[model samples]
Target: MKITVVGAGAIGGFLACKLFAAGHDISVIARGATLHVIREQGLRLHTGNDLVIAPLRATSEPKELGIQDVVIFAVKAPALPAAVDAAKALIGQQTLVIPALNGLPWWYFLKSNSALSGTRLKAVDPDGMIERSVPTDAIIGCVVFPSCRVESPGVVRHMSGSKIVFGEPGGGSSSRISEVADVFLRAGFDAHAHENIREEIWLKLLGNACFNPVSLLVSCATDEMIDDPNLNTLFVEMMSELLELGNRLGISPKIDPLQRIAITRKLGKVKTSMLQDVEGHKHVEIEAILGALISVADLAGAPMARTRTVYALARMRAKTLGLLPE
Candidate 1:
């Protein structure tokens, strides 16, 4: 299959290398230093002591890549709109578009079984740009569990985790979901086709919506935050509020607040992706991770007071640091 991965960042570069190595025709849409490095050398992935590189077709303009069999969006939420607009030429009628992103996605309500189905999230897609650009039928919801970072331009360092879950947006079985899962499995990932992708997304967001923003505000790693008494208490409160909010939205993730924190505690000193973005002086995903959740809560008339407080502080922090638009 011909696959074009938009945004050659940590996850995108990792996927490109893995898929290319697995005998898929791979191309990447990237810009600046990442594009230069990929064009000169190749997409590189470092796992432990070994390094794997794939010489792939790299371009900043999506038109050069033509329509792909699959287009995987590995960009952060903040950069998604522009990435989608730029990569329009790579998506066709038969193409499958997978957003391998963190936090609540823009298309959360499209084809959903919830009461808010067909509602647009202003936090993630304020102008309906993403909703207008990508076809709903082409979308396959994906939740990535891998922890990776761009060690350098065109290079990704795999830290831990490799589970990826794929499902149709509306839920139920589909051959396309199985096909994508098989593709990832062929590239050595623990991929599964789920019946309810939205539930999986909510399960992941239950942790990310709490930890990612808090990590940015506190400027600490996962284990450190979990070990601190006050911060741990704050996390529990925020997660509890999110749990109630999820219930109102007709999504129930089977884990409690304390159990979820325990899962993160086991990850040991792990730095969240949002914290890493702040440290790198890049734009943080404040909207997708936090704002989107708050928006959904408001839509469902669910109160998320503690989560709102944390979000305000984190948003102000990112804005003051110039990592977010004022």
Candidate 2:
């Protein structure tokens, strides 16, 4: 399969290297030092215990690569609009666009079976740019679980999980989902197809919604925040609102919020992606991870008082640090 990874960050690097090693024609779109390093030295991925270096084609401009069979949209939320615009070069008639992003995606309610049907999340995809650029029919909802980080400019470290769940948004268990899963399976990871991708999305969002903001606000690890009585209560309250909202949205999450929080608390010293963004002084995913949820709550006519308070604090922290626009 011909694949183009858009972000070329930790998860993108991992996917590119692994898929390249598995005999897929992998093209990565990157910028700055990361692009330079990948072009010069290929991609170095350290799975903690093992290491693999796979040569791949790297370019900043997507037009340089031409069309691909699949374009993995692994970019951050803030970069989605630009990424979608650039990704047009790689989208052909049969091209599949897989978005491996976090939180509530732009197409969450399109054709969904919910009262919030036809809702558009401006927090994630403001101004309908993504919907305009990437049509809903070409989209395959992807839920990624690879815990990776950029060890250096061109190198990535795969920390824990290496699984991804994907499905068609309109509830058809199509061959495309299995095709993508086969790619990942051949690359030596757990990949599965789902009928209800929204459930998986919300299941992942439940943990990220609470833990991510708390980490950014307190600058503490997941276990530390989970161990704190005050933080635990705060997180549970936030989860309660999410659960209620999910109920209203017709997505009865398989795992309840408290059980999910308990499972996360046991992970011990794991730093969330949000905390990493804060420490690196990069633009955090505050709006996508937190603000979007608040928007969902408001749209669902659900109460999110606790999440609102946390969003205010987290957004304020980002604003104070100048990571967010005032």
Per-model TM-score on C-alpha atoms: 0.98, 0.97
- The worst-scoring run of ten residues by lDDT in candidate 1 lies at 263-272
Best by lDDT: 1
Top TM-score prediction, candidate number:
1
Q: How far does residue 302 in candidate 1 sit from its true spot (Å)?
A: 1.6
Segments of candidate 1 deviating more than 4 angstroms: none
Q: By TM-score, how accurate is candidate 2?
A: 0.97
- Per-residue alpha-carbon lDDT of model 1 for 1-326, expressed as tens digits? 99999989989988888899899999999999999999999999997797999899999899988999999999988889999999889989999999999888888888997879999988888999999999989999999888888888998998888889999999999999998999899989899999989989998998899889999898999899999999899988988898888888788888998999998788777889999999899999999999888888888887788899999999999999999943
